[model samples]
Target: MDLLPLEVAKKVRRDSTLVKYTDGQFIQSRGDSKPGISIVRSGAANAGIIGMDGSVSMTTLLGPGQSFGEFTIFTELPRTHDVTAVGETEIYQMTATRFTRLYDNEPQLSRALLKTALMRSHILLEMLDAIRRLPIRERAARILQSMSHTAGNPNKLECRQSELAYTLGVSRISLNRGLKQLAELKLIELGYGEIRIPRPALLSDWVANHCNPAPLAS
Candidate 1:
């Protein structure tokens, strides 16, 4: 639903070890078998894969208060993707045993995790639907809208054009073209490494108008 409940978060922090990383350092790797959950304490991380050709395919950005690796703890599986520090970053890491103990003692913790998993699934479904039915501009608009809504500041999104392009499964040139169109329409303003939505509602409205329509009568 929302970010992890404050009480549960406190408990997580209590049991976790504080870990720090510098810019571009890996917090976790794709095949690591360590079972633990990590919460962003400060700064940010990018969850993605670096291709053999050295291209990055970013899946999502994790800001402070976001927790990852829950599935890894539960399934005792290796990490699915690499999570790297965007800048200097701090993370709270709880081992599987400690997390399980906290989980057993806290009903709210379990519920919150379940909600987080469901929300992730819902977003994935929305992304797939958008990819199948929407154009690049509308897809960009929809994604930016979602990111801004989730961010602490609803009008600002901390993302790079390359990361956004990778998330959309588009080339940087194509994404730049779509983004420029949105800028021309005054829906967003692109900065060196961020996007500014002057009015988030306008972006949402534009996406709805362009991406959704009433079905024809049979």
Candidate 2:
């Protein structure tokens, strides 16, 4: 993915600075009245709604170079979900009014925002489909496939097991168990803060066969 351009930074009316967050910090919250857009400069954050039982069902994980909360620019509605930093993070932020003007004037910026939103929808559909049709084994395999696609590499990804568990809405121990099963099946190898999928096609087949055959359109 391309760096969110420095030129785009010029378009933002708010003075840009690095905002720091500790682990489990809520950068944005559900029902928040404020309207602002944030671009991730480093580290990780998740955006999603809270369930009836107060569990967070993450819609998407934002890593370096990703942005979120742009929908606030188009409407006065409160923030749709909480954005919490998973670890120490740095983000550049701007108010919704300025972001709206930028979106109207900059075609590339608009395209970038739309692309991120679409990708988030796709990931959410995959997660929901896994819950509906996949067993634990297939869920693990499919998660690997989806992450590989998002990372654009089966060989390299900067991820942590805790982050993966949060992204999947599962416990870390559960994720570890599922991952071990995949490793025994020769589907993937887990390393410190990363996973390597030697056989992405095979894993995709496992996902296609076991998970719901089609993703729901958003």
All predictions: root-mean-square deviation over Cα?
2.2, 5.1
lDDT tens readout by residue for model 1, 1-218? 14567877777888999999998999998999989889888888878888888777777777777788998878878889988987788999889999999999989888888887897787677777777778899888877876664444567776789878887899999999999999999999999888899988888888878877568999
Clashing pairs in 1: none
* Among all candidates shown, the one with the greatest lDDT: 1
| Native-to-model Cα distance after best TM-score fit, residue 116 in candidate 1, in Å | 0.8
Candidate 2: the clashing residue pairs are: none
Model 1 / residue 30 / CA error / Å: 1.0
**Which one wins on TM-score?**
1
Model 2: how far is 99 from its true place, Å? Answer: 0.9
lDDT of each: 0.83, 0.71
Candidate 2, residues 1-218: lDDT per residue as tens digits? 26346676565525455689987798988898787788777777766666677665555556766677777766778887878875688788877666667677777786677777787788778777876677666776777677666443455454667756766767889989998998898878889867788878877776676665667789
RMSD of 2: 5.1
Lowest lDDT 10-mer window, candidate 2? Answer: 150-159
